[model samples]
Every structure is written in structure tokens, then in C-alpha cells.
Target: MKLGACYVAKDNELKPLREDAYFICNKEQTLDVVDGVGGWAAKGGDVGEYARQLMANVIIAVHEEYMLKRSVDLRRVLHETYFHTKVEGSLTSCILTFKASLLHAVNVRDNGDRPDMAMELVVRVEAGDIVVLGIDGLLDNMYPTKMEEILKRETKGQAGSVCLKKVAQQGMRCTTRLTSLHSLHSLKLQKRQD
Candidate 1:
């Protein structure tokens, strides 16, 4: 399977990189995305840290699972993932894994909640299916019907890299516009907050 991934950040923003992160393991038949909620962003620390920690844990879990011959277990993997996150006391993040055509997700719960990924899910995949995983920056930009159309039309006509480029470009446009709006707010509030 071929996958494409990208993120866009404004020039010299407080956090140049957004909190959304992903991992692609073609060799292990796994794709993971983690959306970090308002952790340091709200607390005035490193705004991008929760995501990096979660992403690292997911990558290590994927590698460990890849070495085993048994079928993958999403629950077990997530349990191990929490081990990495809990060191910071709590984690406010969501995780999703796509293995082959199967989909498993653990929804985001705010800090202080139990780390229970009991939302059982199993899905079937059709031929030539392409999935777009992103944070609000990309998703808030495109409508569902439009996104489906992009996947259907592009995946059939272009290579994996080409399709991903198109999608990322579209996401970049969304974030750029969103950032402009945010910039106005940030500038206005800069003096007030201090």
C-alpha cells in the first residue's frame, strides 16, 4: 500500500509544526495517526510535545508488532502506547490504526479519564480505496462529498504519490486560510494577554 502525508504551519508561528502526527509502516501493514488535543498549547509549554510523544510510542509499538508472526491486536498495542504517555501523568490524544483493510480506532478522551479503547470496530475495504487521515486543518477545509470524490478520482487515475500530493496541497490551502484568520486574533491578543 502507498500512503502520503504532510502538514502545514505558518511562518514563525509559536509552534511551527502542528500537533497532528502519523506513522506509515508499509512493511508491517500498519498506518497510525494521532491527534494531540490541547495540552501544552493551552498550558503555554511546548505546544507540539504531546503529539511527538504519542507518535514515538506508536512507532515503537508498530515495530514491535511487526516482528511478531501473530495477527496484530489493536487493544494490546494501545495498552503499550499508554505506558509511554502516562509517564507525563496523562495523555490527551486519539489513535487510529489501519492494517491492510481493517480499521481500529481509540477515541480521544481528555485527561483524567480512563484509557479504555473499548470502542470495538471492524471494517471491510473495497478495492482501490484510499483513506485521508488528518487533523482539523485538512479535514475542516474539505467537505465529505468532495473528499470522497478526490479519493475516487485520483486514486484510480494517478499514482499513490501523485494522489497524496493533490490531497496535501488542498490541505495546505485550508491551513493557510485558517492561519490568516488566526494571525489576526493572535496579533490583537498579544498585548492583552501579557
Candidate 2:
């Protein structure tokens, strides 16, 4: 399987890269955890650290169960574990393999917007089809029509990664501009705590 990912952040923002990620493996076992320490606490050193530790706990616990049954629904396991742990201001998440052919994605959000993912010009995905979880920053500039244009213009396969990387590069350029036009327009007001 091919892996594709992207993230954008404005200058003086609370979080640099949004504290989230995903990876594809040879086996049908994969999990992604995130620490959404909202507002000031996310910027605070101690609280940010606490959130990371909480995520680690969730991962370890889920990983143990995953080892037992490769078919376990990791997302549900993580949700149950987090609820049982009762860690304040922290949300646990997991994306596990259910079967050899099926791929499942699960997400839980506490206070912030869910993450956004775009599938463009890929033979695997269709046009005008967007899957957005709890993040909202990418949706402001991306609409149904706009997404269709992107999906149509992009090349299939490796082109998806290239397109996503271009987005990252374009966002990086925003940081260098004297005016905050690009950064301000692309990033959501809620995401920009600066």
C-alpha cells in the first residue's frame, strides 16, 4: 500500500504540525494516536507532556490487544481504554486492521476540529469524494467544486504524494511572505491561536 500525508500550520501557532500522523504496514495492524491539548494547555510544556504520556499509554494498551487478535477493532479498544482511564482533556484513537481486504479508519475529537484528507487524481479514489474526520482547517479553502478540480488535475499514484507535498511547500512559503494573506486564508481562525 502507498502512504500519503500532509499538514499545515500558521506562524506563531500553538502547535507546529498538529500532533498527528499515520503509517501503513505490511501486516493488517496499524494505529495512529493523537494528543489534542487544546488552547493554552497545549502550548504549556507540562500539559503538552502529560498529553503525550496519555497517548503513549493508549498505544501500549492497544498494541497489547492487537498482538492477541490481528482482527481486533483498534478504534473501539482505544475508545474504551481512554474512557476507562479517564484522562482529562485527552482523546485516544486507533485505526486497526479488521480483515486482509478491508481498511478501517476511526477518529474521536475532544474540542478542536477534525483532521482533513484529500484524495486527488488517484486511480484508487473518485473525484468529488472527500473524507474529513475531526479537522476543519483544510475545508475552508476546499469545497466540493474545488476538490473536484484538484482531483481531476492531479496525476494518479505518485502524483497524490506530489500534490500533497506541494501543499506543504506552498504553506511553507506563506511563512516567508511579509503579508499574512496565504497563511491567514488557508488556516482556520480556530486553528490559529496566535
Overall local distance difference test of candidate 2: 0.41
Clashes of each: 0, 6
Give all TM-scores, in the order shown.
0.69, 0.50
- The number of residue pairs in model 1 that clash at the backbone is 0
lDDT of 1 by residue, 1-194 (tens): 55556655546666666655667776756666555554545566443565676667778887787788655566676667666653232223334456667665554344233445334445565666665555555545544565566666656434543555566567666564332221101100000111
Task: Candidate 2: list runs displaced more than 4 Å.
Answer: 9-26, 29-37, 40-51, 80-87, 90-101, 107-134, 155-158, 165-194
Candidate 2's error at 63, in angstroms?
3.1
- Evaluated against the true structure, the overall lDDT of model 1 is 0.53
Per-candidate Cα lDDT values, in order, are 0.53, 0.41
1-194 per-residue lDDT for model 2 (tens digits): 43344444455466554544333343544434343435546445333443455556556656666677645554455444444443344433334332444445544433454333211111133343333221223333334344446556774664644564455355454543233222111221112221
